[model samples]
Target: MIAVWKEWAGEKLNESEWLSLLDLAQRESAEEDALVRGDLPVPPPPVSGHPRVTPPPPAPRHKVPDTPPPRPSTELDDRFGPWLARQLRRSGLTQSDLAMELGLTRAAVSAWVTGRAEPRSEVRRQVAKVLGGVQQFAPLERWKTGAAVLIGVSEYTHLPSVPSIKNNLSALTEVALTGLGIPHSNVHTVENPTSAAQVHEKIDLAMEAADPVSGGLFIYYAGHGWTDPRNGRLLLGLVESNQHKTWTAMEFDRLREQIADSPVGSRLLVLDSCYSGAALDTLSAGLSSASRIEGTYVMTSSNATNASRAPQGDHFTTFSGEIIRSLTDGIQGGPRVIDTDTLFRHVRASCEEQGWPVPSRQIGRDGDRVELMSNRWGQP
Candidate 1:
């Protein structure tokens, strides 16, 4: 949008300090009102070569904001990745579903979504129709304003290695989450953190990177997890984490406190390890009225008592793999842009059907609206 505006305004637009035309117009009106009310002095009009600005044509009000103006179909074709990804997300259609419908391979759909390949003209039209036409997908503001800190400990110092944890980290940060339009630069990772301080360091950086008002922070931990036997407090294993020495592990409540104190109001935590669901009790208190944080949410791989799975030989852990599958494949009957609530439902259902430990979550204020990814179910 800024690029489009820059192309239109050219010399008139200040690249350093960019403000929306609507904001400028509103600010002008407010200044005029203040002048009329004797609250601010009215400046004399420029007497030289300065030109008075003309207001932009009125924008027709619509149910959605940030809806782009109509452009040539060729232009849409040029941005096939964004267009295809958006429709898939909004329609909740899966790559496999679309592939089956078009009698093409799922690889073809994935290529289209990722912009590695484009569909033929006729096929593009078919896809547009299948996903409720070629309407613009405008729910990306959340992704644009969001930042993530993914910490995965695949090879712990003392605990048994959950080798698939590496796959969980890579697939999520590099492939699945990026499909939602989050810039790769905005996603931070702590692959094999040595100590609790390193985990805190990554999260602190992510918090600093995100916008306090509109931006969100997503912190994911996928490795060995432990709970104190006496009180069930969740702890994430670091490289030197020991099962017997619980204090050697990264205390979740400590991380929770940092997140609660951070300026970013919208926050999410995705845990894919054993006893992760235990954070529910802690998050419930950490996100109470006393803290007054909004859009704080969680999704754990298992319940407070059960163990999460890694199957020994799979490329990805069972839980995180399911999440990647859900995002990539899309829920056929779900909403276009699936929120965490919707994601939890799909994951929980899959786990229940397979008799695996079910995922867990407790939605915070406006947490449902804090969408994490686009539903890929593009076809009915």
Candidate 2:
């Protein structure tokens, strides 16, 4: 019946809605069974408003059904917020103390402690790290299903292509898949996508293989970028992208919508191209002024107005190379899990030291953390 309704409605329900529909239906069925078994009172019939003829019933109020609770993914954010709050108190750290340590505002720290707000994915990872150091906390569990799409375009038809992009792709694939131990079959690679259609197709294929329920998704792209002259929008350079032909470029806005619509619980997008931050601007435009999408993490190699770096004689682009290095070496401390926040901080500092364009980062929501690589076996 639900499938039939979806067919007639011309839209399938999201996972949350589908699960709620099933739960509500099950409860209704149980109630009907109880009525048939003579263990419950029958609901009263509606009274007619008309004097002689029965009046048509009022439309049903489609109140949103109660959703099931989400499974706990972390200690501080999920099941034991209050307990973690207590732990923070016992650790002799004031709300300000914790805030200063995490480089967050005291209000933000208070929100997490008082259950008013959850820590963003990277923040949550740091929370676990900080708390774990002061106290014996449980280690974070790795996602059961992990998938990645590594795309590179070194050969372009119109634009000055980013050279050695294939090297970037190869190194990234190894870092994310082989070095990180993401299943070989779960990783998708697209080399030199020649047109917009090819790029979209590969992204769609990767998303299709991803499982939002149990795991995460990782998307990495290394290429050139151009701002659409007509509207100041950013465009990703495909193999056939032409600076004069707007249609030939992949609009970063459309790419963002694709990632935003993904069902994955955790998503990591790493864009090693110029002006990729414009995509975040597109997503954040409006009265809200802030972009907040749950479970998505983005790291762009350069801001919307800056040029990304490609150091001479390097096999990979500067920003991309630094990111890969941080992931492989593990950030100074033994943070077994390398979150984007940690890696981006490292990258930004490195860029500043070397006079390269600093990278930009955005986190959509809390609890969407994706572990880039495990540092347990030590660096390779």
For residues 155-199, could you state the per-residue lDDT of candidate 1 as single tens digits?
866888988888888877864245555556778878999888888
Stretches of candidate 1 exceeding 4 Å from the true structure: 1-139, 175-177, 290-294, 378-380
RMSD of 2: 20.4
Best-fitting candidate, scored by TM-score: 1
The candidate that wins on lDDT is 1
Displacement of residue 16 (Cα, Å) in model 1 is 43
Off by over 4 Å in 2: 1-144, 285-294, 376-380
Can you give the TM-score per candidate against the true fold? 0.65, 0.59
Please give the RMSD of candidate 1 to the true structure.
13.4
Output the worst ten-in-a-row residue range by lDDT, candidate 1.
10-19
